[model samples]
Target: MQKINKINQYLLENYPSIWNTRLVWMLLLGIAIHIIFFFIGFVSHGSPSTLQHTRAIDDYFSTGLVFVHIIISVLLIVGWLIFMFKNNAFKNFYPGSRNKLFLEFLQYFIIVFVSTTFYFSYMTGFRLFINYKYDDETMAKNVDIINRSVPFLSQNIEDYTLENRLSPKPFVDFYCETDINKIDKTKKYFVYHDRVYQYFRLYPKTVKQTDERGQFIYPEEEKKNKTALAYFENNNDDKSRTYYFKQQVEDLSQYIKTAAPSYYNYSAVFYDNANNPSTDIRKYRYENDINNLNNKEIYKQKQIVINRETIRILEKKSSKELEKLMEDFLAVSRDFDIANNLNARDWSAMVYHPDTFEVRSFIKLYQTKPNEIYDPNKAPEGRYGDYTKTVVVDSAAVSSDNYLNENGEIMQDTISARDFNPNLDREVSPKDYFKNNISGFYYYTSDLETFLGNVDTIKTDDFFWDAVHLYIWIAFALSVFIFSFRVTDLRSLLFSVISAGVIILAVTLFCVAVAFTFGFKGTFFILYTILVVGLLILLMPFITAGRFPKVVSSVFMIISMMAFPLFIWLIFGIVNEHQVAGCRSQVYVSDTYLNCRGVLDDFGLKISYAMIMFTFVFLYLYTGFIRKWKALPE
Candidate 1:
């Protein structure tokens, strides 16, 4: 208790202004208030899991909370200022030099400003915490779901073969004319040539021999054969109809050789013998003259051959079943392509590849025919289950003839290959295929978008530092304005403030007028001249011993204290401009020249250091001069 009393006595003697002003208590109160505000900011909004709740929270924090904070700060500052005026301890009892007085004012100003504005630090910390937590959770969930849902292609022979088979390749010609008539006229079907030939070989006797009047003797068989024939003849005119048939025929023939080698061998021999008339006649003569064999045995052998071919064609249809199996394997390929191209950094999280099968399929199945997927007015189901609640496609997604460049410049081009034929030129990897397209497909809930939008790239530490630096400058300016009341009478302080405002306004208008009339160089010249004249006036107290000169010098000292940093900045700008002009005139300009040789690198830090150094120097000079001016007789 004795030690505490001694320390209090020491503070009373050494720093009476700090002791009597109740600065410590005022600062403690400010800290307590800030702590309360921080808790309010951190916990006011409940954990929101839906878009509606998130939006409401965002509105309250961004607008309503900020407004309330500002009002409270204003009230606190006003009450504190009134309390400081009532005490007036520094003005009454302190016998400190002007420099010491100014330092004291700085201390009070910083405490008040921090007490009022420290909530920003807490709020910033809270935002950063929420953003980090949400981003980590969302990224983890998205990556897991995407990996599970998408099938990645690997470098393997089996996969390569599958890719080729599914991909659109050049057509091969083969005989498919036999089954051409089997195709339905009402529906569209891809034609293969080998299937046509198989139909003719299977039902060779189905062709009708019409009478002179073209009357139907065998109407049913004739009609069927005629339909097949007509389809074959009509489609044969298409030059590109030469695909898939050759592979089909070879596969079928190989199957036949393996499955029924005896039938294949016998059919080959029988066709060869029947084609030669001498062999046919010799067989008939031998049957009639010696064996007396009925034709039933020969007819039965021929039926066996026909039955084998019929079973093979009907069951396998030349690997048509295999194609269906491949389609099933690649069912998620389109959806994977769309999801794989998503860019989380982008606000829309969409990266479109118009040439991709996924994009083409979407354009065809959704955009072109909205009814096929869902009503246009209603939200469509997300491609990847519940990860998204809405899907939006921009109009640019449908445009085929124009695309944006790196600089966002639009260039014209021919219609993309995907638009011409989506099946053609299929890429092995969806990433490789999506590089050229600019269209977008957005699929995310509004809540998710809000979370993503709030995920700023700025580090929390950097934000806090910036806020501190900005508020310190504000505190310094406020301190200087308030300190003016201590140094002079109310009338003199008011006159000085009004005069300063008027001079600043006039100078700004004149610089603007000069810049508009002449150029930036004219404005620069005017500012440089004003800085020189101010410096000259500041030196007047040392040059001449007169009340008028000392008063003028004192006023200029105050102006110079503030304007010195700006003067340094202007000089740096002039030097950089001169260097840039020189670099531009050179014929072989390097990257250094392009970047202006980094003349203004770390400019802010340099300027800040300069300001700090000059501030003390100006205070010493101003206070010393003021002492002498006060000593002189009025």
Candidate 2:
């Protein structure tokens, strides 16, 4: 007891500046924690040098995994933070000394004001500054090589754009609204891209499997495995998931008796798809799949025979005529890639339903989808998938963005004005267009025959908003926390700006660190939510005491608060959008929503919740709602 009393007396006697000492200690603490977190993230996620090699899309794929790492790190940060904040060690990382007055101001600034503002900025906003930037024809030729410099990293197309998706009427008529009976029995309709071949029906119908029983009691296609049959029998699980895929092989000889009609392989398996359709399905598909190679070789030969005959007919036509037809087909094809390099002699086309088992004949030596297929970087279901079939042309390096719309109920074509001069609807740009004759018009009819081969329309989603967007939403909470707390004193303003900045910076470093390690895009938004809420939740306890007045010190925080999101917009511009190289700019990319959205959907609508929050926060501070704490230092 004597020793304890002596120690207390000695500390008071020797160190009259306990608060100054603590401020130094807290600053150090923040720096150390930041360092440790950075190291851990670096170790687990791999260094930035390593990440540079990993493609941007690869990072996207592992979003869930990355976030888990963030969660674990957050727990660690929180544990250390408890030690620091509870013992008042958090002041070590800041400039303020241990002086009681300084420590008081530092706490308000470091913990509350800064963190909320910045992290929200990170999520919703982005910008870039770029121009054609000194690339001539030769450099343009080398652009592909430059972007592909990363080993194993390849650019991909984000297919969510309107160009890639089927027209709503056709997408629903052909792919979406379905009757199994109608699809299989009545084909002979256009299926989008350039299949222009004969089919008895649009889709074939067969009873999808349930248990070992085929919809058709045919013993030939019965479920082979006992366990498979049992699982298939569970209608709740199997039927909900299973559906039949059936189509009739056309006996084309009836139309052209001279051509031999062969019943060949009913189906073929493809890797990426049927344009370059692989006979090899050993990698991902079940070994026992009907499309499996071991069992399908005999069927392959027959299909080959049919394919060969079709190729021969295509050859009989002058290659020039065929090339023109193909170029035209490519130009009007929505979501197709018409490249410079294609087998001018031959190109193949294909289409399939993803959710259905109803894939068609795997055509080879055909067309390839462009590298820039239409998918936006938004959310799943954000856009359509790759629509072009990869076709190889002799000495062809295809780069044009022309494609026959994915095989659909109708085909969209561009007819030269000289071909058919329709009356002009409006002003025409004759720059690339030939001597004009046709009036601009687009139309569609229920009867397939009445459809005009050409049509046009346009719009942009400049202000499209979505609720699922992460940045837009968390800004809402941050805005509210900033605005809602009533602070009349100047320190209220001081605490807010200071703490908001520090806290936001710390949280962002922490969040990005964790996201880097674990691959969590979702966590980006969640961290934004947590920091904004945490600032509000944790600070609620400190508001009553002057010693803890970092909670609400300054008043009239409106001006700065209202400008927060705009400030973020400015930052993205300065940083040039921080995106991976070898990609097009996304600064003005339109917003979109997934079927299930929480907060970001509003951004798609162009509604700024962050702005709203800032306004309210500014209002709260201006109204003198924040009470003064006596001990809060100036």
Candidate 3:
């Protein structure tokens, strides 16, 4: 019994060679490494991460990637378990070699590939999913995604009209409604857009069904055009159109999102593939007789039914009667909802009257009362937070809402930028946008708002840094493959292992440098493929370091470098545009920002060029092949 007990103890102690080796440890270590990189990417990327914090931490993290990470983690653990339990796994993985040290180092390479493949799956899957703008279930439908979403080419600016829905209500925080209680009736009011004369409708006490030019831009259409259209929005303003983003990208972050509520302006939003019945609400587009006010009569609703008999138009020719009508109209409307169904007059500006229909604010046309021109001296200040200074830009001189007294004298109710001039302030104004109109300046705020996010490279890292992460893993993978063939002679074995390592790192490092110059794009995969092919081509020709077949290796490496570039050129040429390329969005964004990621264009060529230079240097340094090919026998 004593003999058997000692024998059992000895077997147990010697069987497991390394205490650190355990299925749990393998999984833990692999998972830890992945997590480390993921976190680094998250930080460098500066986007929200699902794993960095617990559920309680909501301020900065996105829950979007959490479940996917959990699934990946579980899969990795399973893979580790499979590797640990299968006895034959070693037979296929770890092989003997003449150089014990090389063999030992190679073992680590083996594990990384198996583990990496498992970890790499998450990225691959996510990228594939990204090809779809929204989840399978929630892609925008009925409401066709504004032409920018699909196809290699899209519509031009002229194709769009005042009614084009390419841009939804994209900004929320900036617009605010003015108090109607203070009206400078005689002074022509100006809206940023709709540069037209305002003829007040007597019956509705609002802007007549149409304006002087017959352009039917009502409340919402006018505001959107002022902010997003014109020279700034379309580059039509001067020589540039993509306002703020295209022209005034002073602070990229500020443009990231106008505010939290309006993400579509900045953020690339997507829903879960399984999300049922997408949240798109384009079905309830309102229709009323507001399209043609000249012919249509108003609807009088009682007990949830319309009574057309009550739709008589009371014509008040005098100013007092008009004033009473205006008062009645103002008091009646809390919001304007229905618009452009029939005519401008058909639109209703309800005063908290939820039943007639909810219009936030509709047109209000009144008879023009002759008033003094705007006096910058009277209204010294504006309600906006501060007078913002501009750069050397061609901006229009802007005035704030006028400050008037009860007697209608131009009083200092508000202030004007006392020293504002386009040359001095360099900021565009509503007047600049609405060059044609100063008539009743229409202003109102709407909940039709948007949120935005900037598509930017994580500030903490650049393409070079991103390349380094891959280098380490690649190094590990190459070392494993080279060291696995441990049956060769010591000189040859050492030569092969070192040669493989140098080639792997050379190609990768060269790629790193080239990628930084060009852009990350597909350089990594290109270099990786080249390195792989180069190794395969060189393997048979250069069996050992002593027998270094310099020409074979050089030829192989050259081919490897050229292959990636040739493929890149072929792809770009065939596609006819950048759309088909990988992560071209990054390239597009970079082009906007001093062409920061411009390196993507020539990365493949740069890599090939680098290899040529390397070849020349290598040939000059290594003049002749090793005279006595084989190293001394180990």
Candidate 4:
């Protein structure tokens, strides 16, 4: 004990400034701890430079790992700085010793500036490299995966082309009324089926092709349209006859549905009477039978088929084989519909019930339903109205301030029209707005512009507010430094700034971890809720301490430092989540989300909290230092 006392006395006399035994020991301990943890981190998790190659998504595990790494590194740096200051390592070389406060400020400012620049540069560079890694082999693998995933992706175009190519021609012969002849051939009308040939084929060619008076004749012949054949082959005939009929019904339903849906129902045309028939001809067998029987008249012709090959194809084909063929055709049709941007509901209907997709019925529905094929971007004039023009076309005719309606009248106070810029909207054409303004490919140019704009706006706004916030932090630090050190020296100010920053960062990190870990769950949620409410409790005593003003002020300062970031987090966390969700959903490209997600995730709760805390400390110290500004003698 006597020896220790002697040593302390000697130290106090010989090294009055840097001879505090307790601080010296603490400095050694701090150094040891920092080294140990840093080494462990390097061994367990590869260096930050190496970890740059790791892929991360907007999820907890990856983000948490990164956060822990950054937080630990910051803590170590701050701890070492604190140890150096406490041990008076810079006492002789300190900037304030030469009374050069500008040099001190300039040095710290460069440190902050360089650190911020390097961090952002490193992160953005890594992100760019990762995004561009999709080379030819990777692209080929992706294509193959997509093809395998969706069976129809490869066959849509092929099937659509084949169906269209084989579709039967429209009816070339139709029976109609004429002033000159009782029965006249009309080329304009279409008979849904090939009944003309069906009826004629039954009679041998040796029989007179034309009956007396040059009038074509068929008394008893089977009517055969694709629809009738389809029905008879499935319901009315034996397997042998069914197969023969099945070959006749070519899978032209897709084509006929589009070509002439209203007229393509039945194939045969029947006169009211077989002889001395009236001008009226009926396409339905039931209607012809009823009309002829009611009027006691027989029609001139019963049924006919023109195409022989239509029936020959199914001659020996089994029902199962026909079913398989139909399945293949349906698959292609369905695929084509999707490829051509067909309505999902319509395509589903065609696939589910091909039999219901009759000519007349489909035509009526198709004509009445809205056409989904049209593109607003490439619409002809007078099609999509002026709204499409603002979104799709680039023109000064409708400036941001003055939006012209179709009638040439200015639309007053229209928010969308007033703020409409091609840069913000994803639909803007490459040739119009993107090519000149953006550097990257045309596809992502508009989205990149919007995302970058969002980032710029956020950063500028943050800086504007942060400038004031920074003043508060620096002012508080300055007050604390002067009080603690009993001196208004630049060295003290620097120590104070660094000390305050470490505390704020440490507290902010703890709060962020609490929030992130709890994820607003039951007990953790309650803890935060109490902390948020207790802010008022922490403030009330300071506000009401009228008798002991100095004590109250000191207590208030401490409480405010701890609670300020939490307050900001609660308010802005909610706001930022809303902002991110809105912006993310609106962006057409994913990179915007990728770029912004790290900053905005957890509602930017962590980032904003940390930023506010740091800014508050800087602003608090700086504000006080400025009022008592003085240039000490060199």
Candidate 5:
């Protein structure tokens, strides 16, 4: 108790204003209150959930708690203001110069403002906690899932297996055909042959064919045909002739029939024995058969028979290969399904939704029937009348039966039936239906865009800190305005406030009129003009030599409390605009051209600094002048 008294006595002797205002006690209490609010906010925070009712309850609790905290802060500040006003050290003739008085004012202002807005810091901390505890883990899990699934899903299976003898294209074609018609289309030899031919055509590989001398027939020599050369040179000149010639050449090659591995030897043998019919009877038979294969329909039937035989041989050889490819596809599909299910669950939890009851009430309010008893359980229906109408385009003429005069001549109707509406006669618009029926959760889904928005907001960046700092300055400005009454007499305060209000109203009206007459630039010019005029008024006391000017300047000083920082900001804006214009004019290749937001991005810090510097400088001079003016005789 003795030590406490000694400490209190020491504080009283050294810092009378601090002791009288009970500033320390109030600040400690404020800190305690903020800590309590932080815990409350942390405790009340809800995790993402699937149940709509649970989310709704959490939202209400969190929102209501914030509101209550804000109200309590307001009350606490009000009480602190009352307590501080009870003892006026400045009015009591306490030992203080201009600097001391300004410092005292600053101390009071900082304490009050900080106490009021410290909640912002606590909230930011809570967001940081959430980001660390939950969001990071979820993001890592999502990234892992994406990494595991995307590579396989993005691959083209056909490209991967193009070199394999038993390609997966046949199986895919078979699957698609079965899916569409509930039958294995591959069973048909023509279908299977067509698929195989298409697969080889799409993924063309070099095949070496030998001449009778056993020398390989190079593709370069085959492509040197004069007719093919002529077609290549002038293909665009005749589209139909080019297409016909291309198909004729392809048919002559019998590419599908000869390209099959099983029939390659047979084709070579047939080619070799084309002119040796007398040497071998079987060769003579084949030669006769080829010479007789002149009819197009007979050739097609022979091709079909060849395809049937080729398919039977290939199927027997590659059934196991086909099964392996199918298994691979199914494995990839299963992984994709797993990833998709995880994404859906995460998305459902991350999306924002309003309270279900609130949404229901809003719908009920807007969709109620005009003359019927309100029934919550009944579904709302739109009123209807003759609402459906169709417009006829490029009509020849109106029928005489529809529009005719009494003498039977056709007459135009001045008032069209389409223009007449005697009742509520429109179907409900799509927008209204969507608004009344759409769930908030479905409407605001957790897509990439919404996820990015949430991340941007919650991330602890310069933007978040800047916003918090800006609020603190705003609170400080309010404190200064409130404390201005403590520094001046009641009559002066009242006169200054009323005169400032009138001047503000007049200036606002004039600026609005200028904006209407010209545009935003004109309003901007008017505001700058007012800023210059106010600056001149602020400088008048220092430059001029009279009590009247000083007194008038002092009155204007109270009104200009908030304007000091605004003046600096406006000047900064002008300089930034000039810089942006200069950059735009230049042809420099740089990021400045792409992003020309400003000269400096830390606007909040700059403004806060301006507020502090201008407040100290202005208040220091003003306090001295007011003190001297009060001493002078009227």
Candidate 6:
């Protein structure tokens, strides 16, 4: 404590101007105020678990604390700037020789450097502590919640899936049947599956056959074949008959391949018997076997192939088959594609019975008009299960109020993938829908809002407030430059400001050129160039002593000093732009919501860059000052 007092006494007595500078007072006071706020929060919040105080104070009380911090910071800066003007500390220092000039510059540089160093160190230290506290508190809370819930949720687990309409308990059952019998035969069967949905709409499953006059239908055998024959005869004049022929060809090929492999073998054997009997006998030991190839399968395959080939031949012979067919089809029915284009919206939900250890599942499917996923008039035509009991999985869950209008149709503003569809009768597992959503029974929570609402809200005001704190120091530095004119005269002040502007402009243009030429590589080079140029400017005064040279030297000094605060801010802006862009592009994950988690890391990196630049500038000034002082004649 005595050593600290001696050092303080030394600075106060020997470097009175430096000791009295606003820069020093502001930093010292700002840091003291921050420490007070930290202590207040630690006490009021009870230890640290309840202290959600981030770098940007979360609680109302913390915000008030920050307000006080800002007020003190402003007062310190304003009060010190006033003191500099009143005391004429700016004119107190002057050098008789090169050595003395260097010594004077060194003294001023140390004051500014130490002030800046202390200011940043305190700000960053306070922020780091707050951030760590928040992280630790969040972890503790989550761990406690998990610890309490784990044992209760671990028992009687059954894999509930929407695909099979399976329930965790045997007593719970689904009403919907996915089986694909004909709509008429099943009384009530939904064509929810893609294969069945497309098939029934596109092609007639039970095509009716007619006699010569086309007056009466016949209950005939080979129903599809007979129907195809009748359709061909009736539409022989119309070129659209080719569609039927083409469809027949496809059906025949598939049927022959899938239904009658034995017939294919029989045909191969017949050809070999007639053309290469010796080779055939060598290849097949089943030549005399009774079950070698069945007659019934051979006959069935032959008839199908013959019928299809005949239709295919007729189709090829028809002129402009596709064009005429399309025209005729359109002419007959303009809405031919309407049914095929039905909008299919699927929704899945899981219902957990915490009391009975049963999880009821529901998959609501809506086959609606084209582009109509939600219909207000109809409330998903009475499904077999309890629709009210259904609940969305974590990923699929969203408030209906966000999407649905007063009339129950999708609102204009809230039409997105997350919007709930009222025409919806589907429930797909959140896991199945997102594939990336959380899995396991342990992840389920009865209150989704409660689970998710605890997330920290991103208050952009916090960042701006933090930035304001930084800019206050920048304002102080700039004020020093402007106020330095009181001692140096208006001419020097004008020259410094103009020269600084020109230098910055030149540097900016050069950076642009380099960036264009070499891309990021060039920008990196420019950054190094800035470092070199900054050092050169700091040392330039030691090399010359003319009035113009003095003016130029003073200009560069002020510009370099002023640029320090802005340079750090510029680096921050660039990093911030990059981080925001990155976070915007990225999909949200559990640990992050809109880049909130990276705030501390981002700020830390900026501070680090600032520290590096400041250190380089300091070293160059200090080295030049000492060298000149040592070289002076005693």
Winner by TM-score: 1
Residue 276 of model 1: what lDDT? 18
Q: Which of candidates 1 and 6 reaches a greater lDDT?
A: 1
Model 1 CA lDDT for position 554: 44
Which candidate number has the best lDDT?
Answer: 5
Please list the C-alpha lDDT of all candidates, in the order they appear. Answer: 0.41, 0.30, 0.30, 0.33, 0.41, 0.36
The window of 10 residues in a row where model 2 has the poorest summed lDDT is 449-458
Runs off by more than 4 Å, candidate 3: 1-111, 120-135, 138-352, 355-472, 475-599, 602-632
lDDT for residue 295 in candidate 4, whole number 0-100 = 34
lDDT of 3 at 568: 44
Model 3: per-residue Cα lDDT at residue 72: 54
How many backbone overlaps does candidate 1 show? 14
For residues 478-523, what per-residue lDDT tens digits would candidate 2 score against the true structure?
4334323322324555666666677568767877877789887762
Candidate 3 residue-wise lDDT, 1-634, digit = tens = 9975665456447633221123234545766666554453334322222111222122223634444545654575456546544543332333222333333443444444434533243332332332232222332231122111111001011111111111222212121112222222343322212111111211111222334543322334334443221111111122221212111111123222221111122111111112111111111112222322211111101100111111111112233432344333333122221111112122222212222211122221112235644321121132221112121112221122443332226644342232212232443333342222223322111100000011111111133333434544453434333332322323544455466577669767877787788876673466456745554653543453335454444433333322333444334443323333444555433333443333334464454444434533432232222211212232
Give per-model CA RMSD.
Answer: 25.5, 23.6, 20.5, 29.1, 23.8, 26.0
Estimate TM-scores for all models: 0.50, 0.25, 0.26, 0.25, 0.48, 0.36
> Candidate 1: which stretches are off by over 4 Å?
1-14, 49-61, 87-89, 92-94, 97-99, 124-446, 452-461, 505-524, 537-546, 549-554, 585-594, 597-617, 620-622, 626-634
Model 6 off-target regions past 4 Å? 1-32, 43-68, 95-356, 360-491, 503-544, 547-549, 561-634
- Flag the better candidate by lDDT, 3 or 5: 5
Would you give me the overall lDDT of model 6?
Answer: 0.36
Candidate 2 Cα outliers beyond 4 Å, as residue runs: 1-498, 501-552, 555-634
Mind giving the per-residue lDDT tens digits that candidate 1 earns over 1-634? 9975776677778877766555665677777877877666555433433222233334434556667766877777677667667765555444447766656666667666865585574565456555555455654444333222111111111111111111011111122221222333233223111111121112222223334443223335444533222111101212111111111222233322221011111111112122111112222321233223335346434434433332332244333432333233233223222222222233111211212112221111122133353332343443222222112322233233464332236657543333323443543233222223323333222223233223322222255554565566666666665555555435545545565677778777877787788766553477576666556645754554464644444455445445555665666666656666676667342433545542565365555656655765666566666556545544
Q: What is the C-alpha local distance difference test score of candidate 4?
A: 0.33
> Model 4, poorest ten-residue lDDT window?
194-203
The whole-model C-alpha lDDT of candidate 2 against the native structure comes to 0.30
Q: Which run of 10 residues does model 6 get worst, by summed lDDT?
A: 339-348
* Residue 53 displacement (Å), model 2: 30
